[model samples]
Target: MRLFLVLAFFGVLSLSAGVLMSGDDQDVDWLIAGGLFGVALAGEGARLWLRRGRAKSHESSGI
Candidate 1:
């Protein structure tokens, strides 16, 4: 998951710069960048939620 998040982050970053600097959007990167960004964001959110739930359960269980 960490590797995936890093990969997605770089992909989006590089692709975003490429698309913006280019004079046209006639490339596959434009489409792929959005997907990578979305996946990364979703992964981050899931990880955050899971961590919070774990902490709450741990606190309740007196562990």
Candidate 2:
């Protein structure tokens, strides 16, 4: 979970940098940015899924 958060943070940073640098130049970094953003999304989704699973398990266990 922490690892996913870190990866997502880096992905967001890279995406921001790419967007900032691409000032109408059709830069290739845009692709990198998109990919990073996708990773970020995936990481966040996975994190949420894991958290939800944990919560359900805890509920079932009466913890």
Candidate 3:
């Protein structure tokens, strides 16, 4: 879970950098790739979070 969150954080940083890039360093393909990578990492992080929540709930309910 913590690992996933850390990956998501790095992904977000990459995406932000891609979007905010300017001058001669900007590339549309790189921007799109970064955005996709960020989304994927964030989705995985969210899945981990939801799975953790469901596990806790089930344990509490004696399921």
Candidate 4:
């Protein structure tokens, strides 16, 4: 699950960067890049929050 999340985050970053740096300033490209960025951020944030929650629970349970 962690590997999957990391891959997804990197995939979004790559796609966004590719589209934005393709020398095309079209509106659609911008929209796509923005969407990718948003998705990447959300994925990363969720992974971080979940990890933190799991660690806290583990500590509380003396794991």
Best prediction by lDDT = 2
Best by TM-score: 2
lDDT of each: 0.70, 0.77, 0.71, 0.71
How close is every model to the real structure, measured as TM-score?
0.53, 0.56, 0.49, 0.54
RMSD of 4: 5.6
Per-residue lDDT of 2 in model 3 = 78
Measured by TM-score, how close is model 2 to the native structure? 0.56
Give the alpha carbon lDDT tens digit for every residue of 2-62 in model 3.
7767776777777666666644766534766577676777777798899999898877555
The TM-score obtained by model 3 is: 0.49
After aligning candidate 3 to the native by TM-score, how far in Å is the CA of 56 from where it should be? 0.6
lDDT of 1 by residue, 1-63 (tens): 775768666776857765765556555455556666667677777888999998988775556
Ranking by TM-score: 2, 4, 1, 3
Question: Taking the tens digit of each residue's C-alpha lDDT, what string does model 4 give over 1-63?
Answer: 976777677777767676766665543355556666667778788988999999988775556
User: In angstroms, how far off is 38's CA in candidate 1?
Assistant: 0.4
- Report the Cα RMSD per candidate: 5.8, 5.3, 5.6, 5.6
| Candidate 1 regions with alpha-carbon error over 4 angstroms | 1-28, 61-63
How much is 49 displaced in model 3, in angstroms?
0.6
Question: Which pairs clash in model 1?
Answer: none
